[model samples]
Target chain A: MKPFSTMKLAVAFGTAALAALLTAPANAAIVLGGDNGWEVSYGGFINLFFTQSDFDSQVPACAGPTCSEDSTHMQEGLLPAFHTLTAKSPEIGGLKGTAQITFAPDSSGSKAQRLNKGGAMIDMREVFFNVSGDFGTISAGRTLALFQRQAILKDMTLFGVGALVGPDGGGTSLGRIGFGYVYPDFRTRFTYKTNDINGFNLEVGLFDPQETTGTAAEETDTPQFQTEMTYTTGFEGGSFNAWAGFLWQELEVQASTGGATGDIESFGWNVGVDVKMGGFNVVGSYYDGQALGTLLFPNVAQSYACDAFNCEEAENDGFYVQGTYTFNGKTKLGVSYGESNQDGTATGAPESDNSLWTVGVYHDINSWLKVVAEYDHQDSETLGNEADIFGVGGFILW
Target chain B: MFSKINIVRFLLALLVTASWSPLARADEDIWKSGLNLYVRLTEQDDAASGRPVPNQHPVNLDPAAIANSLIDIQVWDKHWFKKDEIEEVFSPEQARLLGQQLAIALRKASPGQDIVFAVSRTDTKFLGFRDLSYTAGRAFYSNDRLNIIIGDFMRPPDKFQERATSSAGVMEIKYYFRHGRRDDPSDFESAVMTGDGVEVYNEGGKRRLDWLVIDVNRASAARLAEEKAGEEANAPVSDEALRQEAARFAQERREMRLEMARMRKEVGSGQTGAESTAPIESRLKTLDELRQKKLISDEEYERKRQDILNDL
Candidate 1:
């Protein structure tokens, strides 16, 4: 109740501020402490969804081929809605400040929080502050990495399934971090854009280990550092976009069980190309990371295999090509086919190959609203065969 | 086998026969009218048949000097004609024979007035078979406009009923001069003093209007005035500089008056009708005779040719 009331107040304030901003002249002086100086923006979406899949059941070591479409259940529920209130400060000495507090209500009770269960939830997301200027931008808060900016920036609709899953297994992931991966630290990074030397742009980022925990002065047993460099090239034809990025991290952590004391070096590299030609847009990516040293194996056990010699390196490489041809800007038909292969070099374990295919139609009700219905099928040779899922959802943003 | 002398004589006779044919036709006479008009629809060399370049000025209007009146109608297996020979020189009767047939053929082949037709033609000093040909004829009514043709009827429509001539001259309505003189010291000084009391400069009698004489070749009352003017102007321009200028002008003007006094007199007098046509027609037959007869030469002929090409 308290949240709802605060949201209503925010909506009123934001509406008034927007009206003032729209009416003000570009060079007009704003009243510092009044509605003229303060801006609030409110946005939210509600979803009613039903999902029916065929292979929702769990099987143990089934020798025969199983249909992914079976063992599916149909459910209907009112998913929790997401809303945000953003406040921007009046320009002070050519420096402006922006702070946003977002609220995504969780309606999917405890069952929603459990593993491998279908329930509706809000998965409260993103609260951050940003300041930008001639000398690049410094965001002393949480944010999606620069690598992920293209996806969120280009996503037009407030409601619809995205091209990739969000970290919370909702929303769209546009060629960014995968679902279930979150950067839980306040990352401070500086980026220097090298001059466009021959159509190539180089950007490098360094994330400090202490920015997130508010324990900069405290000392610990092990220190970790993560650094990444990305190089991008623009095509002269204006249709194709490509980027290659490499990430390296050094972590000092105790062994999971005992007193193991060695520096662990992890590395991940990805190269991606996106092409938008007439009537079709296709994207493909290849990712490889240090397998045995950092990445967890695909076993049901909570403990990692102990033997470095016997353990297979964490090698998961997957590529997907999705094409969507817009009949009009508002209506599109999309088809995607992807296959991911993960092989562990350990004995007695088979190589795991996962394949996923999807076909969907998306309709934009308007700029801020859209509806997407998709049928997705996945086959995991390592995870007991297959899974089929069908979902329809939409969102709104203003 | 035939003797060498007889073979030589036979070959010479054939050469003489070819030479005689075009000169005989040239004696028939050619006349020019007034101002050559051209409205170019395409940048095509063979405007009638060549492909048109895209998105350009689809229409052009130009006024050109008429070069000849001979309309070369090719007859096969009769003579070994030079590649430059474009039109057949014919007497009025001979011309009427071919012209009428062509007119009828033209009317049947092209029904619209938009077909290409010549407005004027020209010829030069020595002529056998002219490397170039000319045909002029266009008609204008109260409701219609002027149509001038120079070459092949590359235009899509319009066909005319008559022939073309080079002596065609045009009347100037008004002339425009830029306010400033060309950026040269001599030209600037001369331009400063050319004006009368008024600010405007007058250029009424700068050039010899002798083209007017060639345009109307008929012995009308107007020809008497032109003859008198010609005699006074031709009063032996003795200054070397002026004489050189006059020669240049004469060389340019000669194509329009192909049968000027000398050539006309050679054919028009001192011989019977059949023999009279032989001089001009004989020279018309071969490129060698063109230089040998001094009608046009290795130097002047080449200069004239290059000039016409440069004009093109």
Candidate 2:
């Protein structure tokens, strides 16, 4: 199935998944089919961030009042409220069973101008099952893409802010996503993750191949291959986690003349490190790829390129580094700088380069509530524009 | 689009969560609740709103405020308390100041925790099944080591106090115990504590909230300041290691408790059996002498004296 249809199917499946999960009676374990070891629980957070942005003021205004025109309005932060349902089965024959369903209702304004006015549509993000024991864990289904998984999850801006102002505001803080690293869009796959040998973990998987734009035709039939190796250890003052990720996928785009662009290979690799000592934390991430867009682990044809009858591969590389200090336990102050540059592929082809410098402060009030404020200065070489955004938001995590 | 299947699914989910009650939960209550408030409405009110809580009474001048702190009942099992289950137990006015007051304290103690298991789960124990009363008051987990807060109280000092004999005001105690550490009867101290608690509120009087401030008597803290302190000198360890160390530390603690009990019973007799007037310095000197005589090793001497002084 095409990626777009598969996404729609995922949404369809997600709508019913949460009902069963959220409705499960509050019991220590939701044993089914006499599964004594089965345990189920639900957890999630609700976040809403209102923002105001002042672009270079060079771009012309829209002719009429349209939902997309308003940049100074209440918008959902990059990460919307998400619901997770988890079930774990006790060790049976030395192996345990794990299943999870994660869904985030669309709060972005893409469907409607007023927030929440666009009735929520379940965006099922993760639905997977796994069985594991001492050897390791092998999982199959839909979940986070292996590439750049650690970097993005460790991105503090994930819990803070990043990217465009609205319509959807930011769908799960892109945190330098399109600018520093390609968003590792979710994919269906079968994966194997080794149990930590010492403090090192290794994961390798086969993913469903995606069709990139500008290709003459769909040609490759093989699955995409990806792998990640991470090392985690703790010392006197703090701890550190570092990882490297790589992925390769073949692409084919069909031409209108019923011809094919034959075959093109896309490959990307990312490396990142996270370190913390006392009240301060530092994160650095860098990635380089061919045929990969500047930011996204790329979900669109726009990120890559297409020639007369073939897809043109481009060299892309970007890096993001952040430093943050925690105040007592309730508040944190942080600043980050990042840039993503995609080398031009053709004569006069747009050379896309994007960079962002940002500072943010977050305060956790009690256990359920949090308040955050951030300011971002974004420059896009491709668009030849710069935007400054200031935003403040609150979230209730249950 | 309100598809029939979607509607049916939503209904089923709502019913399931609605039917759940932690008190009537499965073998393992997934709710992970604090203090068991499972009692009659009248008993619940008395435990919650009653002045001079039965055994754990406050020494703070403002008893009402202490009452509020000990039992800030937000939401309880509706099935359990039907008659006295107030919809609005704490009015907005009462909780407003409490909200502001506890914000900084909670942040400091729990840090990133949105749900402080320590403060939220500690329950009021009025369960008088004498034989099962142990099961009623505190819900202690074996794995729980590093200071699982059991709320605050103004304890009555002197020999009557369950934990301490000093009047360092109403201090909160982090109950530390092992499954079966005692072999005899006279052991007094449960755990040798250190460091006073964090200062929650010490301003004048009316608006006072005592947070985690565990300063055991200053005199002992001063005298024992240089008793070859071992535990204090080590790096902060994991709660698991601490619990293990705490369990092994029980043996010497028994000796200290027995020795202190014997000394107080025989030598220190006052009109009222209150705190010992003897400077803890004297006790440390006695411990030093014991170590010199090979009665106790240096490690045992330091640990026991620390426990004895904390008990004092």
- Which candidate ranks first by DockQ, i.e. highest? 2
What's the lDDT for residue A244 in model 1? 52
Give a tens-digit lDDT track for model 2, residues A146-264. Answer: 88876666666776667662323434455567666777766787777766454566777767777744353454455677777766654323567788887777665555232324445
Docking class of 1: incorrect
Q: Recovered native contacts in candidate 2, as a fraction? A: 0.00
Q: What is the interface RMSD of each candidate, in Å?
A: 37.9, 22.7
lDDT of 2 by residue, B134-165 (tens): 11111111111111122212111111111110
Q: lDDT by residue for model 1 over B197-298, one digit each (tens)?
A: 101111253311111112211222232333444454567766666655555555444333433322333332354444443343443445456777887768
Looking at candidate 1 chain A, the ten consecutive residues that score lowest on lDDT are A174-183
TM-score for each prediction? 0.41, 0.53
Best by TM-score: 2
Off by over 4 Å in 1: A1-38, A56-60, A63-81, A106-124, A146-238, A257-261, A291-304, A308-313, A345-351, A381-385, B1-312
Alpha-carbon shift of residue B129 in model 2 (angstroms):
26
Each candidate's fnat, in order? 0.00, 0.00
